[model samples]
Target: MSPASSDAQWYEAKVPPPLLGLAGLFLQHRLAPAGGGSWPRRAAGLGLSGGAVALMGSAAGTFRRRGTTVDPLHPDRAEQLVTDGPFARTRNPMYLGMAAVLAAHAVARGGVLTWLPVAGFVAAIDRIQVPPEERALHRVFGQDYADYTRTVRRWV
Candidate 1:
């Protein structure tokens, strides 16, 4: 049987990454009420957030087109190792996009302390959500996955 088909432990996060990004947005506002980010920073933030959304959408579309599951909580349900589109750039494009959204918010908030939430989000997803997904993928895809990991980065 395929490793992904096995009854592996679920590596679900208590809070979804998007929700965490939302929390970070709120935290950024709370941390700096008078956030007057420069126009350039705000523009850059807007661009980054937009790009992140596009990256996430492309990755999800890739998964759907390949007939695989996009749910991070159920990596075991994945039927493909998706290596094109955003996957070619980063293994965890969804998570990376979420973190990028938070980082963009932080950038627009205009304070060093406002970045804390972005850091927290990245840390939580990387440490908690990514490892199990990698293991499950490795179990299922084996050497192919190892080869993919060698060629592609986890996050850029």
Candidate 2:
């Protein structure tokens, strides 16, 4: 295999974004006990969780409809530059969805301490997972990806 391919494989084997969120949630549960909160806060958390699920499902469905890979680990396999549906809003909708879910989970847990995991999850995605995928997208889609990046937020 080529060096680039090997590197891609290595990155793919690294910690996944969802695992990071799970780790954060585990830490939150261990270090911070859930506290009491108002009903509005819980309702907001549920709303955020629902929105995250919808966004992820929409993005995945778009990928399926476009005949493209939804696997984040294999962005190099993307056959098309999807710029519609959830992609129109965020360049990384799935990652954003994961972050949103983490945030919602934290909120629902009813402790400010839960946010530590949310922050860690976001940090991992922003620092570790996203840059490689962005690079891969740019390599695959070139100027079109650049234009899309110019218009869409990474996470929104």
Candidate 3:
């Protein structure tokens, strides 16, 4: 199998995004010490959490309207290449939203150490989850996908 296909199979076989985020949260809880300096403000955390919710919701809604699958593990199942809504801002709005949520939670919990898991979550999505989906999109959509990638940032 090609590397993209292998990655797609691997991602499909592994735990879903929400579960991965939860695992990262669990890790943060265990790894971070009880007390530390707070780098993010409470208002900022709340704002980020709200923005995450909005972004994810908008992206999902757009997918539904466009009749495309939102599940990244099943990129082959996508029927359309949605570029409007939250997608216009970021190629992987769902993952970006998830990262935002993670960051918000870490900030709300109040510890610089908590940011470690947020970073890990972002890295995992960027390195692991996104590649296969990108490949699938390219295979399915060709130059259209490439154009979309060029115009939109992966994460914003």
Candidate 2 displacement at residue 61 in angstroms: 0.8
* Model 2, global lDDT: 0.83
Q: Residue-wise lDDT of candidate 1 within 83-152, one digit each (tens)?
A: 9988998999998988888888777768888888888888888887788789888877899999999999
lDDT of 3 by residue, 1-87 (tens): 887667667766977888888888787777665753255566777888998989889999999999999887788778999999889
Q: Cα RMSD for candidate 2?
A: 2.0
Q: What lDDT does the true structure give each of the candidates?
A: 0.83, 0.83, 0.84
- Higher-TM-score candidate among 2 and 3? 2
Task: Pick out the ten consecutive residues of candidate 2 with the lowest summed lDDT.
Answer: 29-38
* TM-score of every candidate relative to the true structure: 0.87, 0.88, 0.87
Using TM-score, give the best candidate's number. Answer: 2
What TM-score would you give candidate 2 relative to the actual structure? 0.88
Cα lDDT for residue 143, model 3? 100
Clashing pairs in 1: none
Provide the lDDT at 50 for model 1: 99
Q: Per-residue alpha-carbon lDDT of model 2 for 85-110, expressed as tens digits?
A: 99998888888888888788777767
Mark the regions of model 2 whose C-alpha exceeds 4 Å error after superposition: 1-3, 34-39
